[model samples]
Target: MLNLLSGLIGLVTLILMIPAVLPLLGALNWILVPIALFGAFIGLMSSKKSGQYFCLIVAGFGALRLFLGGGIV
Candidate 1:
């Protein structure tokens, strides 16, 4: 249940992240980072770690993107 919800959130965040990868759209990652973190928190409630790791990785990527862009591109 919690894992499923977390996976869904990760999926949605990934979808949103796709567009945010573009040069000028990097600012979108600011919003995505928190969303992915929320997903990770939900995943933490589940018995399994897969969902939590997935969300964490997604959040990491988003944070990395933001860092590379110097917060905004």
Candidate 2:
């Protein structure tokens, strides 16, 4: 349950981090990206096979946005 919670949070963070429509979201996302990654990582490590896969998707997308969303630093 906690794993799912974290994974979902990561997914939300990923959504918020997307800069395609909202520039302000992009600002907060830069700070939240690492936190989201950590949440996803924790979820991944603690989850079952299925949950792990979900977390992987969250982490992967978060990372993708982190680089492409202008949050690399």
Candidate 3:
């Protein structure tokens, strides 16, 4: 349960970080990107099962974004 929660939180954090981090990187503030990515990696690697669930969630969101209007970003 805790692993699942961590994965969910990490997935959400990555989604939220993208838009905010991208613009800042273009504006000359790219340092946070690696940090955020590292955090995501750590979160995902914490548990194998949870990581798989996280991937499924991300893929689902990606497909939804591609076919629909709403997106994680």
RMSD of each: 0.6, 3.6, 7.7
Predicted structure 1: lDDT: 0.95
lDDT of 2 by residue, 1-73 (tens): 7677776766676576566225435455456656666676666666454544565565566556556666643
Off by over 4 Å in 2: 19-25, 49-56, 69-73
In angstroms, give how far residue 42 of model 1 lies from its true place.
0.2
How many steric clashes does model 3 contain? 0
List TM-scores for all candidates, in order: 0.96, 0.51, 0.34
Worst 10 residues of 2 by lDDT: 20-29
Q: How close is candidate 2 to the true structure, as a TM-score?
A: 0.51
**lDDT for each residue of candidate 1 in 1-73, tens digit (9 for 90 to 100):** 9999999999899999999999999999999999999999999999987888999999999999999999998
Best by lDDT: 1
Q: Tell me how many clashing residue pairs each candidate has.
A: 0, 0, 0
The regions of model 1 sitting more than 4 angstroms off are: none
Q: Candidate 3: where are CA atoms >4 Å away?
A: 24-73
Error (Å) of candidate 1 at residue 43 is 0.4
Cα error, candidate 2, residue 13 (Å): 1.0
- For model 1, state the Cα shift of residue 20 in Å: 0.4
Q: Local distance difference test, per candidate?
A: 0.95, 0.60, 0.45
